[model samples]
Target: ILLPLIFLEKHLKVEVESKSETKGNRNTSFGVKEGHYLVGNQGIYKVCKFLGEGSFGKVAKCTKLGSPGFCAIKIMKSDRAGLREMETMKRIKHLDPDKNHLVKMYECFSFQNMTCIVYEILEESLYNFFQKYEHHIHLCHIRVMAQQLLTALEAINSMGLIHCDIKMDNIMFIRQNCINVKLIDFGLALETKELTTVSRVQVTPFRAPEVILGLYPLDKSVDMWALGVVLASSYFGKYPFSYHTEYDTIRAMVQIFGVPEPEVLEKAEHTRGFFVLDYEDDDLCWRLQTPEEHEQITFSLTFSSGCWRSILKEELHQVKPSCDPREKPAPQENLEKTEAPHTDSDQAKMPIGVKKRKKVFSVKKDILLIGNLGNYKVSDVLGEGSFGKVFKCHKEETEDIYAIKILKYVSDAKKEVEVMELIRDLDPDKNNLIKFYEYFTHRNVNCVVYEMLHQRLYDYMHKPTHLCNIRSVAEQMFQALSALKSIGVVHGDIKLDNILFADKNSLRMKLIDFGLARKAKELVKGTKIQVTPFRAPEVILGLPLDESIDMWALGMVLACLAMVQIFGLPEEDLLTAGEFAGNFFTSDDGGNDPVFLDLLKRMLEVNPQKRIPPSQALAHDFITMRHLSGESAAEYFATAKTIMGSPSSSSSSNSSRTTNGNPQTPESKKLILWR
Candidate 1:
């Protein structure tokens, strides 16, 4: 019901008046007759064919009566329309013109009872293209589509506006010299600075969890979550989240992030409309819940990234709005600087000279040869990422094999090279961190030379393992977290794929991909704005962040290792793992499996404050007391076997230690495994 009568005319003062004139040239600046038609004017427009129709009006392809150029005219019922939508669009006209991936508005008119607005036409929408190709879209094509969509989103958001509708259909492709995307259908656009009721205003499936949970006063971030969904859809050909009904979808969302801890709930209640209720009947009941039950709990994905701009801000005031019938053109200087200063300092080092890179497999440049720094002959491409391709190379000076990260020009080599250099120089020492040697730009490729590693953790996690030493796994993960925090940088993006095993023993791990890493200084407090699922609840709910996030990720890694030991499944397989890893700690349901479900709860506390800090994690009874009593990885495995010696000889050796940790109720411990 965001109609014009709702608020516009009631508050606005229209000063235009009508004039006594001929039928063809009736002059009423702010009024219209019941049956007047602007098309009847010979100097105005010559309507040719109808194009389409929607809730607003009907569209027709037309030609200016006096001009040779063509445009699409949308005819609306003036008698039934309000001026809010028109005014809103008018304000954003120059921000993103229809000519360049945006539908440009020409002249708007309401002569008789009919209102007509002219616009430039485009070929087709991305929705149609995506539907035709589905998952068949090549990776390169997907990246291009993502980039175009990002550009459109960035432009719109910079204007302090929200495209409440960001589905594929709203994006169009211009079929000219090259394919480019355009954003259209401003039917649901709104200035981000204004506040609105929290009923609901987004396409489901693509909507963010915050929107679904009645969280409003939302910024441009809601759009980033949708962008992630669209990107996921490109690869899978369907919404990452889908259900039979909206209720089910909402319920699923709640299951993922439904209840905050008591303290968080208390703090969140400070907000005007936040809900305050504990999930359990009583705090004690929640406390009684076992770790296994907690591990099985799953929440919807959360996303937090400062990637786009808000246009209503002073930064983009320069982009001139389409000339208003009543207002004069704006100052020229304002139009030139059409965006706010980069708020994301991560990109601050990314100089403007570094052109937006293209999507390609290998660097389109020569090998970087440095005798004193490092002599690495770039060989075959090992893997590719958003910035560049990682290649295996042999260092001629040291005759040592290494992995050289070569940033393609299209991948924005300057930024990638800069981040690499920072990681090499500033990153603290940790066996879990990839060693950096040197960084340089060679012609078109930005090269990052680093110590070579053998296999990705993703490859090793799924391999067969008879018995895993939980203690060893915990130590390795803890060391990584410790090292990362020491450097004042959060890994930002941490998952098995980004981890590399040092050798065949699989005991050592090194982290990679600092492109998404964030400094401790820049993060918004309580917001765990990093990777989702493995994401901490604080980050999920837009809370400020801390080292606790690393602990949460480490918790997921431990769960991954434990899952491998007990269930013989990769960490991701647990995403759909039913209640077998349920949030209950009954002896029969779980062997009180310390490593399986119980230990997971202690680590994956939804409340960042409640989550076991890395220092405390090292002392968790289950990890430190039971597993690591001066034992080696092999020795511990032997002890685990001896403890499970015979079925009848069950004196409950492991069971006796179950009560040792003042085990919190199974209900209190809910774990969202990393899958």
Candidate 2:
């Protein structure tokens, strides 16, 4: 009995043999059946078993007659298609001989009137490898796979070819560990310079937005987009725009990436058919129209002036939680919930004009401006995650450096933008808030153009843990939260990381990451969005919250300063500080700064009733001892209105409409803080 070769032929460059390795007559059973023999250009291959089926054909395992090895043979339905893939393989193989991540095509031949494309036997497709593991490949390993996939794509690109259909299924693993994979199944591959034979290419979920939008003159960039989606899916354990249906893919795209540019919408062939202009906030959120609404929006039809506004208002009112009618519920219904993301199907009942955001995405790269609405050039990557990446960008014509965070989920970015607006209204001066110059949806990313400041307190902490002006820093935070309380804002996640230095000297700092902040009254009972270590006792104990939690986190921030002073690191941290709450910051122990300790005691109180609210903290001795910032909400508003001019003022005034349609703005926020 011939033991099937442990290895497979590496290349299609094979030599015909004079003698057959198999003893006598080669077993002739059937197509793709084990022990069946098939003749190729080089030798007779004994069929081992079936591998998998693809768009163009079925793949099966086979052993070469003269060679001591096994190989994969894809039997195509038609010779024309099979040879096309074979030619593509040959081009790719010739393009890069030194190294190729693509699966090697050993040989191709006809048997029983069917065309078969042969390849080295691969263990499994990347999709199957990941699915069997419950989509839990560590990013470290996936990174290696990504490098290999990119190399393969570059090889294909060098040959001026596009792997039109790039997905986990088309990427196969060479070995069981799955670190090294190969690009397989070029059945739908097309040369970049070839004439277009199809209107669109790529699988539904993995398809690029440009392809879906009909952004023509497609190039190898389309393949790059597919690679991004493929890598993102592996990293995130789901598609950046997790659409289960082809019809919903557009909606998913819009949701993941904010609405495309107006020009993109106007130029896109399918826009009219798929999306409708939602004018809820005087901004157009392109929501996929329902069957009836599709035709109306798809075709050029003059809309009744206020037809959308009324439908939008009705939809908004219906979605508003009825349990608490007065207080606007935090839009965090999707946040941290043990459920799937709200899908388009679930929102089908809502009016087309309803501003239900589509969950979709944009991968990195491309020289386009971020959020076509804003004029900025993205340059470098600052940070990255499954949801998004922070890019170093600057105003196109100016040196105004800014960090542009491109989020995968439009919901996350939209939520953050809402909180920023909420905070801005509350603290118009932005004295204690990250100064948001503008935010717009650019290239499907929630492009937030903020005043790029120095490193965060977390980064500064490394330089000198022994905070010199810890009280002064604490004073600014107290004021920020105090300003927030006056307007009913709660900074949900306050940590050293969220507290950033606003100036070069690290003298002034502001709070950021407002995406999680909720209204004090609207915060769901037991809702906890704070990082674990910074979580207040009330939040951890499942109690109701108020603006006091921010103060609690500030207390932890102060304690962290003290811990850093004493141990260079927070040993047990604030969570355990409650056990010795009374003497936690005592003079007898250190007396480092009695004023700071006094404030920490009240701020760290376990009882929400006992915790020092921002209002009283401003009047505390620790704050009055220092100089006030002198930037009152009134003065700041006056100066801001002056700088913004008439147009800005009008926009601000118009934007004052509340969630409940109230046109009245909140009273001027008056707060004092240490400079």
Candidate 3:
């Protein structure tokens, strides 16, 4: 989709183009000062500092004079100016401007004789973030940023407005160290019908020439070009064909990508003076010719960046594409994402001679020091929970994978720290526990790092047949339990999802999710600990608590897998709670394996005090004793019951006990674990 530079200009051309500002308001001085109150009497906005200067007027940082809330106000020098932007923003109002992905415009009013529009304040630009990495951004980081840019552009285009200028400077994150970006600086925005009136009001490096050439009528594709160039810059810090003059810019384009097709040349405006048809080499192609040769024929390419010659596109491509941010990313294979960026000294040697940009603003790769995290670069999100989300992060020094958990502000960090400390004391080398690597705070959020794992047991639950190596999995969980018990920590929430695979093929798993975990001594009176179905009878009945609760959930998890394996189905169909789970043990034929059935019964016994504990489970015949046929040990399923009965029964009855026959129905199933 990039058009070839068919006709190269031998020299720069002077033509009418969009100027940054008009001379009419050059001398008008709006006597506004920082800390001065605006006209709004109830909640006056006092100016903080000037943010930027634009064609309309100045954009200022302002605070609600009496409150801590911050907002931005864009001032129009005269009521007549910025009408286009005002109308465009009003149209966007109905599209839910408050969306975190879009910059929200609150309202407009007159302040000190200037038309002022107030909006939510956002941090520095994506351009600033790009600079922080010194243009050595990772493809993974660019993909995240680019995908969001595409989504935002889709939203803008859907509203039937062209954000005429789509560049890194206009895209920004809501938080200094976050990826949720929003589009800003809509000064040149226009509706489809009004584009002809403002043909050139866009940034030069990101310019789309088709519409600017004054040849074809432009459409949304023009903005797409700008988006492409912006993404292109995240790699090299400059557009591909960038040059000091419009003429040489085309030369740069021609150098990287050969001459364009003949059709592009014929339809292109200003072509008559710059290119000629070449038929001598057995093909008709457009070739760039010098002026003396151009004296016989013509065409031209143009853009407005004034200093772009030395950094050629090929020079950028020379940087390894593996890490280059412009290598059109492959779509994520699975929804499981866990990316983050930073550098940790303990993990790797620091890059040398990096000079700090002075009084720098918010940039993604700013040397964020979070406790033991040291220096690491963040990748993408793994998943999110009620508290916050987890990202795939790497130690800059070691280049190893780790997970970073970012949660909402902690009113008390003491509990989490205590919990982490106790675990380190119990399992310092993290043989069983998902190792806690580091913990730190960023502004209002708590960022903690942990050992990243392969995949979740819940994520692979459909592969009940794969879990046939029951002996291996059971041992692993017990190992994790031994560590938890040593620290007196109760992983009250244990289910398939909370268990992560060490090597999915090997069926090795580990216990996680200490969010609901508490030290046995710190358990609050009347505290509700376990999840549904997996909840031990004692926990549900408000009886005294202990580590026995986990044994019950573990029994249920293995039992569910047993049902799936025995029934030869991909997943379990029966999931009843409390008394309703009687069907589990009472099934007429639960795959008819009495030995495995008895072990589960003892594990799920009604009395927590009477239930099998972890140490005993380790010695139980099912875990320490028996070998699996590699087939599921059976218990409870309509299919299993039918298989053991007569053929007439299998044909006459519907085997599926899943909710209304839909296995994925929420009422019929609960994700044993999600994070």
Q: Pick the candidate with the highest lDDT.
A: 2
**Any idea what lDDT model 2 has?**
0.54
Model 3 poorest ten-residue lDDT run: 340-349
lDDT of each: 0.48, 0.54, 0.53
Q: Is candidate 2 or candidate 3 better by lDDT?
A: 2
TM-score of 1: 0.35
Please write out the lDDT profile of model 1 over residues 1-675, one tens digit for every residue. Answer: 001111211211111111122433323322323222256333477667666645455566777757786676667657433254566567668674632246777666665666666677765665565443332232223434444455566677667777666666666655422334566766666677653543355576556544544444455555555555555444334443443333334333334334554444344322213232335554531221122332233232323111111110112111222112123221122123222110000112221223445656544334545534766776767886556678888777776888877765634455444555556654434436778777776665567777788776555543322122333444555566565556676666666566676765335567776766666676776543445535556665655566566555544544554343333334434533556643311111122133322333433233434444323433444333244333233343333333222212224233111122221112212332221
Clashes of each: 48, 12, 34
TM-score of each: 0.35, 0.43, 0.41
Model 2 TM-score relative to the real fold: 0.43
Number of the candidate with higher TM-score, 2 or 3: 2
Model 2 clash number: 12
What is the Å distance of residue 530 in model 1 from its true position? 50
